[model samples]
Every structure is written in C-alpha cells, then in structure tokens.
Target: MNILKTTALVALMGSIAIPAMAEQRVLKLFTDASDPAPKAAFEQLVKGFEAENPDVKVEVNTFDHEGYKTAIRNFLTADSPDLANWYAGNRMAPFVNAGQFTDVSDVWEENGLKDSLGSALKSMTIDGKQWGVPYTYYQWGIYYNKDVYKKAGVEVPKTWDEFISNCKKFQEMGVDCLTTGTKALWPAAGIFDYLDLRTNGYDFHMKLTSGEIPWTDDRVKAVFAEWKKVLPYTTKNVAAIDWQDAVSNIVQGKAANYVMGNFAVATFKDGGMTNDTLGFMDFPTINPDIPRAEEAPTDTIHIPAGAKNKADAKKFLAYVAKADVQTKMNEELGQLPINKNSSVGDDPYLQAGFKILSTADGGIAQFFDRDAPAQMAKAGMEGFQEFMAYPDHLDAILERLEKVRQRVYKN
Candidate 1:
C-alpha cells in the first residue's frame, strides 16, 4: 500500500472513533415511569440537557413505576446510574443512610434550590444533607365525575358526614360510589393516609412516620373502622383491578368518584374524560371541627454516590431545577411544578389542583408507604389489602403490622 493511501484510511477510522469516544461520556439515568406525560417530559429534558452540553450524551432507562423501588434499593449499593428518580420522605432514608447517594447539599446551596423547594419535602434531605431535587408533585384527593353527581342529584361534599351521606345516596341509586386501585398498593394506602390524617391530624401522622406511634393506636383503629364503612362502595373487583381499570370505571360512568393523586387527571383524559366533566375535592372532614390538611409530597431525583458522571448529573439536575424547565414539565405532565417561580397554565383542572395543593391549611406527606421505610410500606400496604377484604381479622392484621414495624424500626 502507498503511504498516502494508508494515511487516508487511518484518518477515516480515526473520524469514526472520535464520535464513538464522545458518546462514551454519556450519562445514564434510570427512572420508573410508564405514564406518557411524565415520560415525554423526561425525554424532553434529556434532549435539552444534551443540546446544551453537546459533549455529554444522556441515556435514560424507564422501569415499571412500582418495580423501581426494588430496583433502586438494589441498584443504589451497586453500579448506580448517574441520576435516578425516587420517592421522598422515609422512602429515601434507607439509601441515604447506606451512603449510596451522593450528598448534593453543596450543589443545592450553590444553585439556590433551597429557596424554592417547599419545607415539607425537606424530608428528602437526610442528616442535614440534601440528596435529591424534586421536579413535579400533586395532591391526593377525591376526584368525582361531575356528570355522575349531576345524574345522582348529589352535591360536592365538604365534611366527613356529607361524604358518607353522598356515598349512601349513590348506593341508593345503585352507583358504585368510590373507585380505587388496590392492585397498585399505593392507592389503597392513600385511603389510609386520608383517614389517618383527618382522624389524628398532621402531628400524629408525623409521629406515625417516625415509628413513634404503633399501628395499633385507637386513632389507627378508628381510621380502619371509618374506611370499612365505605369499603362496600368501592369498585367491586378492586383486588384484581389496577389504577387504569379503576379510572376507566369512573370514565365509563360505572363509578362516581376516585380517591387518587392528581396525576390521575391525565389517565382520566386518556380514557376520554375531560376536566370540565370532573371535579376535585379535599379529603372530607372526618372530624368537622378540624380544618382539612392535604397530602402533598414531591417526586424527587438523586445522584447515587458512585455515579460515573457526577458532574454531568449535577449539571442535569440544575438544568431540571430551573424555573423554565419546571414550568415546561408541569405543562407537559399535567401536574404542579415545585419551583415557586414556575408557572402553571390556565387549565382549570390543573389550576384547581395547584390551588388545592398550595393553599392547604397544612400538608402531610403521604403515609403508610412514603412516610415509612420501603419494606414497612410494602408490609403495611399488604395488610391494608387483607384488612379491607376481611375486616373481621383486624386484630390479626394489626399484630402482623406491629411485628413488621418492630423488625423495621429495630435498627
């Protein structure tokens, strides 16, 4: 081969290798999201991140939302991703304690994120150190089909008694009054939080989260008793149905309402329902004298300790923390953005959702699951399912919960 020809071939190979080497600096992000809006928003953010940092490529892996908890627990102590999404509250405690996540407090201060994030979400910060950044979050409440209520001649409920009366009214009219997705676990546990919050107030809820109060408390028992009264009104095949099916029951007019997170709005729309046809209400006054406190928690992002691209991950997180990115995320995901300066648009339902969450007299993080460790959350959720199916075995369920709680809190 001639020297000139050989040089040309080597140059061609070098050109290919250069881009491949550039791509090797890619960032890996793993999240548990199947919903279109949030997923699209994440992809959009990745595109924006890559566009701004042309030298760094971003690779994202989205897992089943429910499965992500287990995956993250295992992944955190091993070959963790550059950045990963996780639940806030006691949910993050295990990983934080294990030193599996990078301490982002310094970066959080540098970026002035502490100024915008709500105090309620500070639970994501462990041992006075920030481990994550929250993007979008929505409130948990009762969403009723306006058209169904109109046909049934029932007004929107405000107090606990009113809510029960409304349920009775719906039952009299042969409508399944409440719809739930027990198959997902969290939805069922959400009901428990609402019951507990309205019964014991936010302080006791915190105590419950801290494992200071036993699940066998009278307050806890009262919550179950009240929950049992309305259990008959929930969707008939709740154990077999996931959230989507439960939402469909309401969308198709088989059920009158759903107790769910604000994200359910998008699922409702995907099922051919719209905001005008639906309405949101706070968890009714279980005790009329006390003001209603809403459940408000953030979906958080964290950088694991061993992340290969910590600098790029921090950059990406700061990019996501920007007000513009937050607003875009809210607009795309149909939920409220955590950045105080971020704007949520003029959609009434979205606005109402924002109003409900932001204006709550006080907010408690979701309980049983997020309020407790991941393992305890799992045990409590399963107990809720069993207790719901057989109220007669309440004591046995409580005993089992106590056992698990003892094991979980022993450390």
Candidate 2:
C-alpha cells in the first residue's frame, strides 16, 4: 500500500513539473506604438490573437516612437523579435535589401491580400515581393472651400486642364488658387508627389525617388512644367507661412483649394469651416491611362528575418490582415484600414477617404519624406519649396537634385 501511494504521488509531481504543453509557442513583438491610441489597438490585437490561438502567447515590447527608429537597427541585425512594426515605401527598403525582414509575399498571397490590401500593394512591394502587411493609413488629396468654389462658379474638376482653368478664374477673383505652406518644407512635397504621380504614373515617380531616373530627365521636367501652370496663381508668401496658416487662406476664402492630407479636416473645422463649406476631391487626373494613386502614409507589421517563432509571427500577420480584425483595429485607431473589405467609421471625411483610397489601383504613396531617403527627402523638399517660390529655377533645381541623387544613392 505504501509503495502504491508513493507511485501516485510521484506521478502527480511529474505532471505538475511539466508545466506546459509541447505545442505552446511564444511570439515576441517589437513596436513603436507607444501612444495611447495605437497602444490600445495593439493591446486589443494581442488579446484577440491569443484568443484565436490559445496555443500561442505574444510578448510585446513598446518603444517611444523616436527612440524606436534608432533601436530598430540594433535589434534587427542582432537580437530580432519575432515581429516588428515598420513603415511602408522606401523607408523599408534598407531592411528588405539587407534581408532583415522576411519576404511575406506568401502570407499576402495565401491571405488574398493582393485583392483586399490592393491600395498599398506597390508601396509594400520591392523587387516584386511584399515585405509586410499594412494596417492603417489616411488619404491625401485636395481639400477646398466649397463656398469659394460656388462663389467663383467653378465646378469640381475631373481633369488637370479644367482645374487649371478654375485656378485662372480664382486668380482673376484675387483669390489664391493653390495654397500650401512650405515653411516646414514638407507640405510642398505633397504637391510634388501628386504632380509626379498624376503626370508620370506611380512607377516612374518611385524610380525618380529611388534614384533610378535622372532628375534632369525630360519626364522629370514635365512634372515641373505642370507646376509652372499653377505657380502664378499659388498663394504668395508661402515660404514664410506654415501649413496651418495656409488653412486660414481657404477658411477665409482667400484661397480656393489646398493640396493636403485628410488630417487637416479637423483644423479646418476648428477654423470654423463645416462639412457644408468644406469639400474633398481626388487630385484631378492628369493621365487617363496611368491609373489613380493617392498619398496615404501607411503603417505596417513585419516578420523579422531572425525570428525564432516565424510560424506564429506569420499567423499574427494573417490575423491582422483579416477584414474584420482591421475594421476593429482601425476604428480604435481613428484611421482607415488598408483592407478593402473593412468598414470605416461614420466620420464623413473618413468615409470619403475610405472610398477614395481603398479603390486606388495604382498604389499608395508614403509621402515625400517617407518615400525618399532622409538626405534626398530634405534636398527634394527644399527644391520643391524653392520651385514653389521661383518656378523659373526648374533647371537649376533638377540639376542640383541630379547631383544629390548620384551622391545619395552612390552605394
């Protein structure tokens, strides 16, 4: 009897010592989503991912946004987590090229992301393979004063020529037709991005920014040529003002249109413009055959090349890619989801943006600073600012940029 009791006790102790099933997995996630909103979204993501995958547990490490930018370098090459948060576009090229990020083209393919996340496909791809999954973004387009457009008797334009004609009409009425604040030097980039996207198409624009095309190329000159048409009608003193100040130009009816991101809608409301007075439109089409692309700075998640638990990391990516998951995550995030099947919130601007961006087949761009390297982005925006002030300097600007391109991408 004593021997049988000892055997039972030993069996129970052994069972207790085992602790976990052999199938239990851990996925480590590194993120810069330290802000309240994104943090909550990530928390919800982890919880939901765990619920569906009871066998896997996620451990997340959050970093302050600015610090994470520097920290990602050390971790990606040395002690990589199973997954990491990153930006789309040229911002991700280094990791993709260095093989620090796993090629997630298989995840995208098996999940049908090519159809649902279609808008961001081009931005998320390099060398014909996707590196990560984009979750959220906001649209960038023309936000205009409807009251001013009505007063000027100009209808919303569908083509670049019609828009320029309205610019002439607005100019005649002593109103600035196109207003942007370049004091910060980035907003000028929105105009240039759109001009290049509308004129030369997304591939050419990417090539230009990637230094594959010469700035002195005539195709590049054509982008500036389009800019010249609106220079005489653009708000003057832009070099001295910031983007928010330019918002006042539209608010007070001194300007008819502004090329900006959707985030400016709140600023317009605070400045006393309402949905009735404000209107959003696609940047008028310049090339009928090139397809429409929009500016929507995107945030994404990736599997690290050194990840120990790549299976679960990819499972997490697939979880986030679901339309229902994205809908919930972005609703908390107050941003539009990249999943085409995901539903957006009731905010009219978001609704409009959802329609505008979700349908863009050409691509989504991550804006100038995110799309170009830091040195090149700065030089490019400075050139844009100078060109905004002096359209006549197109040659000098392009030549200077050509030199920088040669130097910046000499590697």
Candidate 3:
C-alpha cells in the first residue's frame, strides 16, 4: 500500500510540472525586415525579449520586405503568429476590419502607452480603439543634390512661385529639375499626397483618402493642376524606371532633386553620395494659407487575433513599446524612433527628419497608400502614375479613380 501511494504522488507532481512547462513554450513571430540593418535590429530586439522572459522562447520567421507583404495576408488568417510587424493607418485598416488583429487598447491603457507614444497613437487607432504599437517612422521631403542646386544659384524655395522659378533655373543649368520613378507607382502618390495636403489641408486629405471626398472634386483636381506645372521639369520616361534607378539621376548630377523618404539615404551612401553632397529640404510651400503638414509613415507591431499565446505576446509588445527599445532599434536601422523620449543620435539627416516631423503644426500624413484603403490605394497610385506620365488625361484619370473610390467604400 505504501509503495502504491508513493507512485501516485510522483505522477501527480509530474502532471503539475508539465502544465507549468507548457505555459512557457514558444511565441512565434513573423517579421519583414529583409534589409541588413533592420534585420539586425529586429534580432537584437528578440534577443532582449528572450533574455527578459527566460521562460519563453521566440521563434522568428523573417521574409523579404516585398514577399512579406503578400505572405502576411495568408498567414494572419491560416497559421497566425503570436506577433507580427505591419504599418499603421489605412494599412492596418483591412486587418482590423477583418478582425484578424487583436484590439490592443487594453495593452496601451495598462502600459500608459497613450501618453508615452503621443501623436503616433492616433495613427494606429481605428474606430476609437488602438490596434498596435508603433516602433519607428521616418519623414518624407525633397532630398536634393546640393551641388546641383548651388550651380543653379537657387536656394530652397519656400513658396509656390519660387519653387516653379527654381525648377526653371535648374532646367536652364542643363539638369532636369526633378527625378522620380513611377514604375513602382507609390512614389508618384507621395507627390500627390503632399500637393493635396499643402493645397487643401490635413482634414481634407484624410477625408479624401477615407472616400468621403470624390477624386474628381474640384479640390483634388486643383492639386493635379498644380502638379502639372511641375511635371515639365521631372525626368522623361519616369514610368520606365524604378525608384533606385531614378536616384541615379540625382547621384550622377543629372537631376536636382528627388522627393522621397529618409530611407533613401542609405541607398545614396551606397552610391558614393555623402551628406555634404546630398541635402534634405521640406517640400516647398504651395499655399501659404494652408498649414504645413509633413508625411511621416509609421510602422507598427501587433498581436494577431488567433495568437496562441496572448499573455506572452502582450509581454513582447510591452517590451518593444518602451522608449529604450525604440531608440536602440531605430538607431540601428538609421530611422527615427516614434517614442518622443527616444534619442535621434548625432546623425544630421535623422535630426533634420525628426525636427521636421516633430514640429509640424499642421500635423502628419501617413503617406498616400497608407492613408487610403488597400483597393483605393492601389487604384489611386495607378491613377497618380498615369497622371504623371500623361498630364493631359488628368480628367479621365480622376473620373476612373472616382469609380474605384465609390466601389471600394460602397457599404
């Protein structure tokens, strides 16, 4: 009888320990940081998280930036990860609407993230509920060739008339006034977003993206009209080349400027262009009456609705939301940390971007594709590219885009 009792006790103890062990099992993470710097930063973040939670193991599955975009839609529904990386704003809207992303507002409230994250919180929130925590974001502006600008004797133009005049002068100096690649489509959308933001203001831009305003409206057409005035100075055959190829025109001194995000700095450096040769400037003012809104697309992380380990996923989100983690990760990736308390380091370009975004009284735009629905973004970018390639067809493009907008938001 004594032997049998002892064996029963041992079995009970084993059963109790198994449950405890299983509680600390793997937390799968799906990420898209194919670039070396961002990938390294992500690895360090995971390493830190693992060290902090010794009981939990993080299984990271990384994909190339482009491949991950398509792969995420499938995985989020079929084999969901405990955590995933994605953009804020309209980019997150589809997943939120589909109920694939967890409502992380509780996490934000519990962790005091609302105060810590500041304005960035607004980008991740939908229907008055927060969806994710933003890790990093960068500013968009006119990155110009300093040498080309100096040779043309043109200072950074701050008004519409001066901007057009400077473009003419640059063309007279035997260089195209601007170089942009619309082959990828989104670059052209960036230009359009800025024009709309500067012309009508942030409220109008947001409404337009949300399908509250028609693409063929007079306000939107006015934006395209302004854009047409600058098109004469942009590179010829823009639709035939990708953004990187277009950057070559600026690097080789064949073009004066490129309106792009801060992420392009690394590519310029790799092409033998340095900060001394390359300069950053805000897009020239179109309407002095309209407040100056900056384009600052934010990237975020979230827990999937089907996450197997909500407890552990919350822990990971909390870990990354801290200012220290944001600072370290963005520093490694050469991007600005979204946390207001985080340091931008001594990099001048980063400092400039941070200053431009943080001080924008007019507020921030999450960029065109990010601020609009996925289907609307797709049709909008195509229309933007078409308008840039053939400005004469502006009315036709707007009408077609209006049809897409109507269909996409048809409730």
lDDT leader: 2
Superposition error at 204 for model 1 (Å): 3.9
What would the per-residue lDDT of candidate 1 be over residues 167-209, giving only the tens digit for each residue? 8888887889998878877788888888888887766776776
Give the residue spans of candidate 3 off by over 4 A.
1-26, 63-67, 288-291, 361-364, 373-375
lDDT of 3 by residue, 67-122 (tens): 99999999998989999999887788889999999998988999898777765766
Using TM-score, rank the candidates from best to worst: 2, 3, 1
CA lDDT of every candidate: 0.80, 0.93, 0.88
**Candidate that beats the other on lDDT, 1 or 3, i.e. the better one:** 3
Give all candidate RMSDs, comma-separated.
5.7, 2.1, 4.0
* Alpha carbon lDDT at 47, candidate 2: 98
- Tens-digit per-residue lDDT, 181-273, candidate 2: 999999999999999999998888888888899999999899889988989899987999999999999999999999999889989999999
What C-alpha lDDT, on a 0 to 100 scale, does residue 76 get in candidate 3?
Answer: 90
Taking all chains together, each candidate's TM-score versus the true structure is: 0.75, 0.96, 0.85
Q: Among all windows of ten consecutive residues in candidate 1, which has the lowest summed lDDT?
A: 116-125
For residue 172, what is the lDDT in candidate 3?
A: 88
Clashing pairs in 2: none
Error of 1 at 374 (Å): 5.3
